[model samples]
Target: MTLTRRDRLVVDARAIVALGGPLLGNNLSITGMAFADTVMAGQLGAVDLGGLAIGAASFNLFMFLGFGLLMATSPSVAHAFGANDARKVTAYARQSWWLVLGLAVLLFTGMRQADWFLPAIGISEDVLPVAVGYVHAISWGMPALLAYFSLRYTSEGLGRTKPIMFTGFLGLTVNVIGNWIFMYGKLGAPALGAVGCGVATAISLWLMFFALLLHVRTHRAYRPFDFFARIDPPNWPVLAELTRIGAPIAGSILAEGGLFVAAALMMGGMGAVTAAGHQIALNYAAFMFMVPLAISSATTIHVGHTLGRGDVAGARDVGWIGIGMCAIVMTISAIVILLCNDQIAALYTRDVPVRELAATLLLMAALFQFSDGVQVGAAGALRGFKDTTIPMALCVFSYWVVGFTFAYYFGVYRGEGPVLVWIGLNVGLTISAVLLVARYQLVTKTRLGAAVQRPI
Candidate 1:
């Protein structure tokens, strides 16, 4: 935490340079889609927006697993490449695909059964139809979405993120066009209204998937292994390794995703206005989270590579550099929120009450950025070490036991409103961040000491 001590973390500048740009770029584009999705949905009507929020919150719970499982792809690939094991990389990639796809089928089925899902989540009667429609329509995108995550993770594992950046841009464009065409009946399409948002999401997903596939086809780094080439037979031992590393990662995301899903369910019990306001805040947070989330990807790759090269100090450097970069990025973004909190809220709505509620909610979100940023960075550090299981247990206690408990008491029980709930949310994230940092510091020091004593 000291200035000079922090300065000592500069051992891996080239690795930082290699990672920082692509991860930040990818995060920004992904954030744009998140922003656009909420803005577009909110613009439709309060009812529609509330429904979209509910549906998305529910889906995110499962998506945490689907996405986390993709983590199985990257670190192993990085480790394999670092060890000069080309065969291992191919083997891990192929198995990671199968692992994530099985998860996707489960998710697709669950979404198809989302009608029962609504009532379980305590969705209000009037908003039920909109929520149901969004869930079902968006359900169709799950397979494409999983495919995209798998491919992207594969690329990142190989120390390539720029291809995904190109695809992300393509996704953003496709999303905007689809939203315009389907939402308002532009381009000779019928005005599908709120449901159109779901359609737009589906189309954007496919566009991103195919665009990346095309890139991989022609890019020299990826060209040697034609899809037609006989890939390594699926390796169960490798699958086991991936699962061991990723299950906890999945659990951690599930816990965090539960925050939104649980909030929506509780808000639905309250009213549409509350649900809509929650969505606005959540949409914004999701955008910001991409920074640390993307950094986690880089941390995993960089750390695995360093470890493979038997450079313990260098691996530690990658983790610290990632942490520093995330702090800077998130802190700068946080300033924008603190200063113009009200202005940003108003953009979400013309309704005075919704605007007021959103602005007040932003206050709860403001200072919490530091905690959220650091916690995500710590999580990234763990991923770099291929450590997920302990974090998963930590998340369960922090998020479900402490986080949801506080949210219920502060937001629901107190009826002291969203501000209290938001404050509680911050408390939960901060706690998680602190614990994760402490654990990582101890572990990193141990690794560094052992490396120093070894006969190099």
Candidate 2:
């Protein structure tokens, strides 16, 4: 029953699409919540939108660290599942809960104290109160958010992505409703404006977490994993192992996310109009990025599974296909952004200056879509191979050393504007794409060579 190369390619494509489809939906849903928050907050006023941007940037800094740590569960679980090591899979899943608890507490404390550092970062007086309120409200959800990540990553590793998709939509629905109710002070609740957006987001996180927990508890498909069959205490060695693998991942994610956070903070100092405009452009770019992000996630799972089955060639093929898919899709997205820049900008706000600035930035955003997609795809492939430390170093070099230096020169020192800042982002993403793709190639070639030389 040996299949032809064409048949195998078709099968690989099908597998990637099957895994990526729901992941795409899930990613989009999550980003949609952010999009909603931005749009709703924008309606309140430019100052409110600026505050949302700063608060969200700060929140995401801590959140990405927790997310990267929890993400260790995915590749570990995928490798175990592919190797048919059910005990190992359950062990990794259980240990992730411990990691989640630790991260939740740490992030919660940091988020609560976020306001103390706002003035140091140059957040304006008018925006500071709103940003503080937003962070404080959202801080309550750190536990739920980390818990959801642990469960979601475990499910993703098992190739059960539909639950994530379903829960994501459910979360989005709840977020919108909560925002309407709380932000506008519907039904006797006091109107809290931008702060209410954080409240809504926090509530949605808890809802999603509990929903996934209930599903894992009762679903027959998850019965074998025994996610709830026994209570396991914290295991330091296993926790350490997870952290060892995850720390570099966290660093890499922080490097990329930090670049954006820095840009947001820099824009904050520029003024409310500039900051609001930047948020609009960045939010749309993030929305479009979900497509490639989902492809990247699927690539990691596919590559890990293939490697676990001792198929190095198959893993390499999957990686390339995933990267190719991302490139092609992003090219199309870039075209769309170029074509509808004004129309898209108009969707976010009515302020003439903000709209004009955002529209201009969207043009620059189009230029970087391909680079963004390629780098994320390559990073995902590397993760599947359990090679992260080098990638982390590469990201830090690309983003901070190369990207920020240029951004500061053009945007801040020169006082050019948000457009020049986006140019820096494009440069960073392009450099990351080149280096990360090369790294993936080198890693795969070495692995393939080793696999061939081994005695069979």
Candidate 3:
């Protein structure tokens, strides 16, 4: 019995939601940790808040690179699971552990060197020390965080998102409590200020990793795969395969995230007020971004599953559906941002200048929400088809070549201020949306057409 188009849409939408809902919860919990950090840091004054902004932006840029590389586990494992190739699924999971561990070491080493170059980036003397300490504090947990990503992406591929969500909430709880203790000098601890936030976040990451590890090890649903039953030695071929797929993903993430981090770094020279304001606006925008990001993850899974089952047409449809949903959701988010930008800014700090500047930047954030949503959605869909190289190029060109160049020229050289910087953001995101969506259309058509021509 052929399902009507409406029926198909309904079924696919339900599946996307069923998968995305828990992922959404997880993503929100993850974002909540950062929100807690920002609000708490704001209370300490502009210098502390400004320091955190630069430190976090730098840390997150690197962190996302690691996460992006490990993300390949999702599609790879999803494909195997969809085809009922349980052995292949387990194999991929085990091999990913090795890859993540190596990345953890490299990232940890890199993070520890923040002191060496942060001042070179124009971070003010007062802010530089704070930023470097915060980064170094957080660097301690890199191993645990990367290990958790290896397990998290494996679970995501298996469509077991509840555990991930649960762990995320647990981490958020731990983070808040830890922040209270460390930042306030409670329980015989000296006040650490912004550095305290780093300590708490790092501790939470370790706890989250262990909690997820225990759950994955003991859960009956994961028993068949026996992920921990036997330790598999490093498999170079498997590592290479994951790397091939993930390297482009890492590049794409870095390109886009790098632009934002660069903007923050650039703001450093303007003064603490501007830096703090930018952080508030950027933080809120990032928190809102998790919605479409979670949906994009689900879309990748659904499309990968459809393709694995040899339903090329279904995969294409799933991609488009996900992209449309993201656009609609972000449109609503933009409305909310516009209507409450002042109130939202108030949530971060009480300083009048910071509040006013933040509210202004929120306007720009609202302007780009739709483009941000659409581009991420399209990128997610393309990953499902394992067509990452071209998307990487598109992102780099859009984010760095078009986005960064315009931002530096108009906002810095022209001395136009943060609004123009955000205009550059909007311009880049819009181009990325256009290019990536076009790429998706082309890839789906070519792949689907080829599939149709194959002999029975």
Candidate 4:
């Protein structure tokens, strides 16, 4: 009962959910870690509390920036698998490791320099030691983090996601426990303050990486890749291909994320309470983005596999289906955020002023939810066709030129304040959706024409 190539591309809800499963697991566990870490940090006094925010903020910027490189692995691996070229898949993975390891070293080295940098961003001297310790502790975890990333995408590339779900739950549990042991003087632990958070997070990542390795080694399908054997030197061609494919997504995400980072820096100057309010709002926004992010991840897989099998029609269907799903999911989230906007904002602070500011910002954020859903889904569709360069350019344009510019204008000069920044995001995202969707259409059309001319 051999399946035809076109039949392989059929996407129903089951397929989409199956594709999104691993990403959802990763999102859920990681979000849990964020919440748990915040809860534990609250017990550590003001200085230590501030330190955790500084460290995580600094690390996330680099982590997400470098994510452009790390995430490039999964789709390439999927493309190779779709083409039924196992050797190419292994080769891509090996090359991806070289690139990821090199960047990991650079990021670790660079993180150490954040101490000199954070104070410049207006972070108080009181938080410096805890912040530096955070940098030191979390920096060393880069290798493990990369290892976990590689294993995760490797699983996804093979159309397997349940393991990621299971592993994420396990890792999150371990992480919270570690936080308890290290942050509060439990189990003969030192109560290392905010530094404890850095230590705990690093250990959690290490555990996830090794556990994934063990899973792949034992699993029947993945066993063939021989993941750890004879990791070869960096191959320039493959590395270049990865950078070409991934840098745009990173740039796009960075643009979106960078605006917030910039806002945080400005908010720091406004005062600790202001920064805290900004962080709380940003955190909620980050959590919300994960839904669209999940949809984007699934879109890439479905599109890539369809294209890999040379099923252009199937690829088209996958793209639209993903976009639709994202719209539906995020619209509902917007409603929830709007209804509970005040209550949600109040969770982070006792100060009434900060709560009011965050509440207003949350409303503005809600307005853009569907727009973000559109842009992310459109980008995911383009990624499916292995067409990235234009989308990359579009992201830079949207985030920096449109998002950042408008944010500064409305947020600062116009006295629109924080609510204005959220509006900027809506503008940028709307433009991004329009541009990327056009690009996706153009790319698939070109491919269809080429395939038709070849005459099966």
Candidate 5:
């Protein structure tokens, strides 16, 4: 039965939401753990909070690098699944596990050496010890975290997100309870403060990894994929292909993430108040970003699946719909941020200066929400097409060349404060949004035109 255009649009929207809903929930749960860490650390004191902010920024740099590399599995698996090529899907998944192991080793080594370079980067004496401790504690979970990502992306590629949602919530629960026990010194444990948050996070990551592994092993949904049917050794060609695709993705994510981390480090140098305020604002913004991020992930899967079935037009439609949906949702999120800025800030800390500054930054955050949504959504769509190298260059130009330059000029050189730094973020996101959407348009048009010209 041929469906009308409107009917197809409705179906596309439904598919996006169905896949994205669980992903959104999962993303939020992950962010919720961060939120819990921030609030808990804030309760201890501004110093502890500041330490956590720096530590978390550093941790995320390595974590995002690993995540970006492993995420290549999603599109690869999705394409194979859509083509009904189960063997290829299993092959990609196995090679991804090997990639995860290598990333885990590298990340763990780097994390252990964080203290050596942190001071050179201007991490203050007050926060250095706590930050170092936090990194050391969290580094223990690198292997587990990488493994979880491998499984999660594999499932996402196969259009299975409910397990991700369930495991995420479970991790959040474990994180909160662990924080209660270790952060405050309950249950005969000494109060570890910010460092305890790292310990809690590490433990929670392991739990989540094991939970997902158990599910994948036992669930009927994954049985046909033969995920455990055979253990394959390192396949150099497959690994190289994944790296060719994933390296740019890692670089692109790092470019954007590094921008924020740079801002945080700069704020940290200013004072604990500034750092804490920046953390609060950034944390909330990240939480809100989860919605669009989930939609973006779903868009990537949808586009990949459609393309696998030789439907370029369908892929194009899915991409645009996803981008539009992200923009609309972020618009609503901006309004909420504007309306509840103060109340939201209050939830993080009682320090009047921190709260006030955070409230002001939330307004800036609100302003950039739309651009953030559009850029990330567009990036996701591009990932589905396995077109990442150009996007990586674009991100570096937008974020480092344009964004960081402005941030440094206004916030550091001029001492204009966090507001100006956030304005710089807006500039970067806006530029990225404009260019990425245009890139998507160009790529889709070129592909569609070629499809038309093909000899039939």
Candidate 6:
């Protein structure tokens, strides 16, 4: 049965959605934890929210870099699973634990040192104490959070995202209650403020890790690999392979994420009002970004599966399908932001000044939605092919060379403010989208030609 292009697109799109739907829920729920923190902290006052903005920016920069490093597990596991290599799958999964531990330890240590550097970075005296406290409190959960992602990404590669989704919702529930109890002084506890948000998040992370751990250990679907059979000593060679693939991904994430974190810090220098406003806008934009990010992740696994089975054409089809879906979805996202920017900002803060500034920044956020979607989508597809090195280089150039330069010039050098800073973000994302799409096209064409030339 020869399927036409439209038929093939439909089939592939269905596969991506099937995989991405649970992931979307999971991503949304995960992002909701941050949203909850932002909203809850806003109630305390602009100072607390602004402090949180700095703390979160610092923590997320490290956390998301770890996320990219562990992301290698998904495509690696997917490729093994696709090839019916159960041993390889288990091996990769087990080795990932070592990687997770190293990342957790390093990040934890780095987070605790925030007190030393944040002060030097121009954070206001009022905000500095809050930021440091938040980081110190949150650092306690680094191990558990990284471990949870190990299991979650492994499940994602195995095409078992529902468990991950369920865990995310559970984490969100626990976090919200904990925030109320700790942040509001409920049940006789001290109102810990921004620090309480960190404490709650840390507790939720550990619980989520345990919940996912239990499911993976007991589920029959995962029984074949016997993942919990025993903890093997660190396999140096396998660990090396994982690092080889993941390091570039970490670099890529850091380059892109660092730009935003830097922007947040720069905003902190301007004043609490500006910082709070920027955080509100950036947080919502990040929340929306998760939609396409989930889709991009699903695309990575799907494309990996196809390629692992040696179906180059299928891999190409699914990759393009995923990218197109991201673009369309983000277009709708942009429209929503344009129509209700103020309403959206109001959800974050009650302060009129903060709300007004945030709404203006969101308009800029809307301008970049298409570019953000396209870049991440293409990056996801590229990951499926274990093609991280070039993409990493490209991301660095796009984010740091292009994005950071422009942001610093317009926002700082010219003293134009955060709106122009956001415009810089748009330009960088747009360049990335164009470059990555071109890369995907070239790589696929080359791979297809190679497949054609090889005699069976």
lDDT of prediction 4: 0.77
- Model 4 agreement with the true structure over 1-456: per-residue lDDT tens digits: 765645654434458778896788788788777667765675554456556666777778778767766677778888888888888788887787776777888888888888688877667666667767887888877788877777787777777878888878887898899889888879998989878878888898888888888988888887677766787887788888988877876776677677667666555545555555666677787787777787788888877777788888778778878888888888988998989999987776666676687788788788888888888888887777777778888877887788879977877677666667678877887788788778877887888788789966
- Candidate 6: the clashing residue pairs are none
lDDT tens digits, residue span 1-456, model 5: 999878888899899999999999999999999999999999988889998999999999999899999989999999898899998999999999899888989999999997896888998888888888899999998899999999999999999999999999999999999999999999999999999999999999999999999999999999988888788999999999899989999999999999999999988888888898999999999999999999999999999898888888888899999999999999999999999999999999998998999999999999999999999999999999888999999999999999999998999899998899999999999999999999999999998899888888
Q: Give candidate 5's TM-score.
A: 0.99
Tens digits of per-residue lDDT for model 1, 1-456: 544644655646556556756866777786687677778877777887788777777667767778888877888888877887777777777777778668888988988887896887568986788778877877888888888888888788788888888888887788878888887899799887767777887888888888887777678897543442665566788888999998888888888777757876888777778888887877776787787777766787888888878877778877877777777777887898899988888777776776777777777777778788887888888887887888888877887888888998988898877766776677778788888888788889998898788885
lDDT, residue 7, model 4: 61
| lDDT, candidate 3, 255-295, per-residue tens | 89999999998887788999999999999999999999999
Error of 5 at 264 (Å): 0.6
The alpha-carbon deviation from the true structure for residue 350 of candidate 3, after best TM-score superposition, in angstroms, is: 0.5
Note the Cα lDDT for every prediction shown: 0.78, 0.91, 0.92, 0.77, 0.93, 0.92
RMSD (Cα, Å) of model 1? 2.9
TM-score of each: 0.94, 0.99, 0.99, 0.91, 0.99, 0.98
- Cα error, candidate 1, residue 300 (Å): 2.0
RMSD of 4: 2.8
**Model 4 CA deviation exceeding 4 Å by range:** 1-10, 42-51, 124-132, 413-416
- Stretches of candidate 5 above 4 Å error? none
Error of 6 at 113 (Å): 0.7
Runs of candidate 1 exceeding 4 Å displacement? 1-11, 224-228, 453-456
- Top candidate on lDDT is 5
TM-score of 1: 0.94
